[model samples]
Target: MATYSRNRLTQLLPFILSLLLLGLNSGQVQAAPKAELWPLWQPTVATGQSAVPDFKHWENFLSQYVRRYADGLNRVDYASVTPADKAQLKALLEQLSTTDPRGWGPATQKTFWINTYNLAVVSLVLDHYPLDSIRDIRLSFSSLFNGGPWEDKTLSVTGQELSLNDIEHRILRPIWPDRRLHFALNCASVGCPNLATQIYRVETLDQQLDAAEQDFLRNNRAVLWQPGSNTLQLSSIFNWYQVDFAANENQLLDYLQQQGAVSPGILSTPDLKISYDYNWNLNTDS
Candidate 1:
């Protein structure tokens, strides 16, 4: 009996050792050093600095590359980016990374972060273009830590390595607190807000934000009024950022109506059923 038990233990040992090795290699065990945590507030305006950084080059890139589809989805012509265009984008990002945003005002800071998020997304997709959806890019190591390309620490801004998630969640939403920001920061997904054909500017930030809200609301893809069920459906963005809509359904409806996202007739009905939906497909030109 002892001899048989010893043989059985020997047989199981190799299998158990293999499993442990696999866990370590997969980053599930023997954890690596933790990455730097994203900050709650990105560095904002400091005293005695210029108000707004020039965005002329960024505007030029957007004007040249972004196109509005008939379906209202703004698709980027990333496949056509030349070496010069890539160089220009790199230079712009480098400048943004090194520049301190502390002296900028609210409007300027808003525009700057919005542009940073959008441009960073474009740059990432450009790095792996020809893919069907942004979802295809997974920067995580294990399925346990699975996240989109947004998780990558692609930018070193103000001395801290930042990801798209940091730019969007930590900086933009908290700093601005304007729900219309959802319409300005494109996610390169079909359900996301349209990528503006022009760069966001501090001077025209309000108008641009208002226009984005109106444009998105006007599109059937964003606000679908189901006649058969007499229900109003909104983009999943509202559901995810419900707190941003003043933490109530009525406020969301009112805000949408205020932005002309839903017609008055559809919005007039009290106790209307609201559902949120989103599409994750790439917003490519069809």
Candidate 2:
């Protein structure tokens, strides 16, 4: 009986350990308090992609409203936007709503989604301007928990409503799986990747994405080396999306090195520990 039990235990150990790891990864072990989902994600289809989205209006909006600071932070002046400009913004959104992204090429698809997600966020913030941060704008009565505007699906497109999370997690990340997007999607927060000052064009999508990645990697928010303690601290993004970054710490380091964000000297250090951190404060113009 003892011999039989020992063999059974060994056989099940791997499966049991895998379950435990999965649970931990899913945040079941120490789950953060998340706001309740108002309405769950619904399936939506992109229209057949044909014409390139004319981002002229979006470009004008960015040039007029977004201010770039010396620290690489871009802030949108939601308060200062005139009524006529807002109309243009609305019309631009409406154009996107009517356009189908189904048959678009990868570049066109990515540009459309990224721009749509960003514009939707801006429109949300503008709807309730004068707030310190985007997190302050919560659903009716859901403000008790400090829930943000992300869950609210305020735009209708392709016969379905869309939210910031839906456009990002559901469509962009799942479809593209590009970690560089972590730097492209702005959360109207200082901790998030800086909002691009210019509009994203399908023609220059690769260059734009590469530039964004390089800029973020060099930023202190994404990486830090504490020579005093021999510790390398990475952005919480790597922690949250480790699979997208790499399979292990060494591979992550290699990725950073390849991006020219880190040096061989940092990689050569022994007995180093890794930690992750993020900031959630609003990225507003003071």
Candidate 3:
């Protein structure tokens, strides 16, 4: 984001004052003062294959927003983020993804990775809203890029020229190691977790992820818990990554029992719900 200080914003406030007045007079809402000129990202070429991005400044700026304005559990009121805001968010993701993210502090790297993942997912949804899944925006026939996740996506991350999956699966998972990531990584579908309103703060990323998981579980959004039956009903994520969740407990129900407060009786019951109905539709409120 470009730097316009409070003093500068105040100086320019009069110019934008007309926008505010217009909103007051008309029913249409005015955009935030720091709105972007281009709804999509403007590409940068300095993204060296050998270099990583420095996220110190980015971390500081985002932290300020989290501390000063974000509400509990990192949930920003969904109604506030209009479609236009998502367009700006899409652009921001491009900038962050292509930019080298090295030379920053550890916390910054962690937070930046989390934010980038969330933004990338959101951006995909906005352009292809009304789709049934993130798969709708296939890598093979990308409108933006002519490749897929299986192809070589040479982007800089933590000083390495790794693919996007490398950053998410290899680099970030080892650093953060939290289960709540399921919520933050939007797949532009109903089955994927809900997008958090506030940017993930490095200072409280774990807490944020935890709250995110709880949000999903509490609503039976992805997994449902049955106390009487002692059975755990969960999403296909557990079915897909049997290895990730099936270690000591060895089954999906076991993983849920470990993650949930419910005891170990549901696995024996047939009444357990195992539906993983994910919608791949675009995430626009409309």
Highest-lDDT candidate: 1
Residue lDDT tens for model 3, 52-158: 43434333333332221121222222334456565555445445545654445566666777766655544444455554434445544331232123223434433
Using all chains and alpha carbons, the TM-scores for the candidates as numbered come to 0.78, 0.76, 0.56
How would the candidate models be sorted by TM-score, starting from the highest?
1, 2, 3
Evaluate model 3: give its lDDT. 0.49
> Better model by lDDT, 1 or 2?
1
lDDT of each: 0.74, 0.73, 0.49
Question: Each candidate's root-mean-square deviation in Å?
Answer: 7.5, 11.7, 17.1
Q: Report clashes for each candidate as comma-separated counts.
A: 5, 2, 17
Which 10-residue window in model 3 sums to the lowest lDDT? Answer: 32-41
By TM-score, the better pick of 1 and 2 is 1
Q: How close is candidate 3 to the true structure, as a TM-score?
A: 0.56
Per-residue lDDT of candidate 2, residues 1-286 (tens digit): 9999999999999899668544433331122222223233322354444576687877888888789778766777777888888887788777776776666566777888898888877777777777766766766543323246664676766657777767777777776778888888887877677888898887788899889888788887788899989988887777766677899878988998898777888878888877777665666675
Off by over 4 Å in 3: 1-87, 139-164, 225-232, 248-252, 261-265, 268-277
